[model samples]
Target: MLLALLGVAAFSLTFPSTAWGLESFGPWSLVALRGVLAALIAGAFLLAGRVPVPDRRHWAGLAVVGGGVVVGFPLLTTLALRTSTTSHAAVVVGLLPLTTAAFAALRTGRRPSRAFWLAALAGAAVVLGYTVRESGGSLSTGDMYLFGALLVCAAGYTEGGRLAAVMPGWQVIGWALVLCLPLAATGAVTALAVEPVRLTAHGALGLGWVAAGSTFLGMYLWYRGMASIGIARASQLQLAQPLLTLVWSVLLLGEELSPAAPVAAAGVLMCIALTQRARS
Candidate 1:
């Protein structure tokens, strides 16, 4: 639980960080560079630890992690950030915990208790209501991207959790990042050539944190937590992530904090507590 909370903390900073990153980098370049940088960091850890290659059976799972996590989520979210505010995007992404729980159930054939499902659904409802109210019941292209990100990221999280049961959690993400290295490198090069660049201190720091902190270390802790608890239970911890992100947006990005944020936070926290106590 501590590990999962830590992971959520790391992820909460991602949207604001991406906003900073966008001050200098185009959406395509930012996403591509993020993948490449994170891959390099993951590669270093794997090589330094002398991690053995994953078995054939794990390759398919790793590929899913590579495509969904290392590529799809970041790309889609970064693109979304181009038009949407960090606070808005964070609220929409609050649905991730529920989505991931559903994916885990389907992938692992494990059924969480009725209480768990109810709590998860309650949390999702809070997020959905907040999102709809915030957006005036209108969905934009950026929302579309974020919605797509939710599905792909949920798939990745489920697969990563499963893989972590058989391997070390860090190695699960480490190898998945390594698997996507070639593609990331190519994308980085191609996107850098086509996209405009205007580097700043904020951009460099944002990029660094997303790569090293969010992508690798965050995932390592998350998978470990999921492996410790069941994925569905652990995923419920993320019910607080959007609120955290909202706070970060105010603190870091200077975004206007919503009046309802506190109420939503309280609701989400209650749901998380219920889900955590519920049987899996």
Candidate 2:
């Protein structure tokens, strides 16, 4: 639980950081550069630690982790944030825990209790309500991108959680990063070729945070927690992420906090706590 909370704390800054990066970088550029940078750092860690590579059978699972997290989630979320506010993105992303739970069930055939389901549903409803209210009661293209990001991210999280049981959590994410190296390198080079970039301090800071913290370190802690506690329960911790992100959005991006924001956060947090306490 503590490890997972640490991961969530790291992740909570991502949306606002990405928003900051988008000021000077194209969404694709940011995503591509971040992925490549993360992969490089992860590769260095693997090399320094002398970590053995996974066997052939596990390579497929690693690919899923890489594709969903190193590729899809970052790309989709960056695209979404191009047209969305950090707060809007945070509200939509608040559904991630429920999605993660659903994916965990599918991946592991672990059935949560009725009480857990109810609490998860209630939390989802609160987040959806917040999203709709923030977006003025209508869905937009940003929402679609965010939804896509959630699905892929859930799959990656579930798969990584499962693998973390038998492997070091850091190695799980590191291997995924190495697996993504070629593609990430290609994308980064292509993005740079197409659009030249002049990096500002803010953009560099945001890029550094997401590439290092979100892509590798946070995932390490998150998968470790999931391995220990199981995915369904660990996912409940994600319930607090949006509230944290909202706080960062206000502080970093100067976004106005709505009165309803805290209310919805409190409601969702209660449902998360209920789910956490319910029998699995």
Candidate 3:
């Protein structure tokens, strides 16, 4: 839970950078650069620490974790955010726990207690209901895009967390960074072909923060928590993120939104707590 919180914090801090990078360079460009830089950052740490290469026993898991979480997630999210506000994206992203819990139960053959199931469902219902109400009974295109990204992200979180359990947190993310190489390269190439960029000083600084904080540190800890605990438990931490994201959006984006943030937060949190207490 501590690790998950750290990951969430890092993500929140860098959340503003996403809009900046997107403005300077499109989402794919930012994602590609983030992947390449994150890999380099992790690799540098590995070399500095002289960490031994992971045994083959862990390779397949790393591949799945890294590919699913690192490469797949960034790409999908960047595309989703192209049309979505960070607040909108955060709402869908909040569903990670519900999705992961379901996946965990299916994978481990562990039967979550009835209370756990109800709480999880209730949380989803609250969030979905609120979203529809806020949007005045219409879901926007951006919402749908983010919803798709969240589905992909849920797969990454569940699988990556499972692998992180046995592997060291840094190693888990490191492996994912490794998996990102080819895909990132392809993305970078495509980005260059379409909209090549040379960052201004401000842009460079933003990218640096994003690489160090969000991609490297944030992602590393998230998978660490996921691996150490089951995804179902780890995902519960995310219930708080959408609220935080809304706060950030109001502060940063200057968007006046629902004044019922506290109520919504409490509802989501209650559901998370209920599910956590109910889970086997």
Model 3, span 1-280: residue lDDT tens: 7888888877775556676677677777888888888888888888887878878887776776666566666666667677777776777677767887887777667677788778888888777777777777888776766676666667666666766666677777776786677887788889867885766665676677777788789878887876765677777777877878788788876766676656778899898778668756
Residue-level lDDT of model 1, residues 1-280, one tens digit each, is 8998899999999999999999989988888888889999989989999989999999999999888889999999999998999999998999999999999989999999999999999999999898888888888899999999999999999999999999999999999998998898898899999899999999998998889989999999999998998799888888888989998999998999778888888999999999989997
Error of 1 at 178 (Å): 0.7
Question: 278 in model 3: Cα distance from truth in Å?
Answer: 2.6
Candidate ordering by TM-score (highest first): 1, 2, 3
Per-model C-alpha lDDT, please?
0.92, 0.91, 0.74
**Cα-based TM-score, every candidate:** 0.99, 0.98, 0.89
Model 2 — which ten-residue stretch has the worst lDDT?
19-28
Better of 2 and 3 by TM-score: 2
Candidate 2 stretches with Cα past 4 Å from truth are none
Best by lDDT: 1
Q: Write the per-residue lDDT of candidate 2 for residues 1-280, one digit (tens) a residue.
A: 8999999999999998898787768888899889888989999999999988898888888989998988999999999998889888988999999999999999899999999999999999999998898788899999999999999999999999999988999999999998888888888888888876778888998999899999999999999999999999999889899999998998889999888997998898899789889988
After superposition, candidate 1 runs with Cα above 4 Å error: none
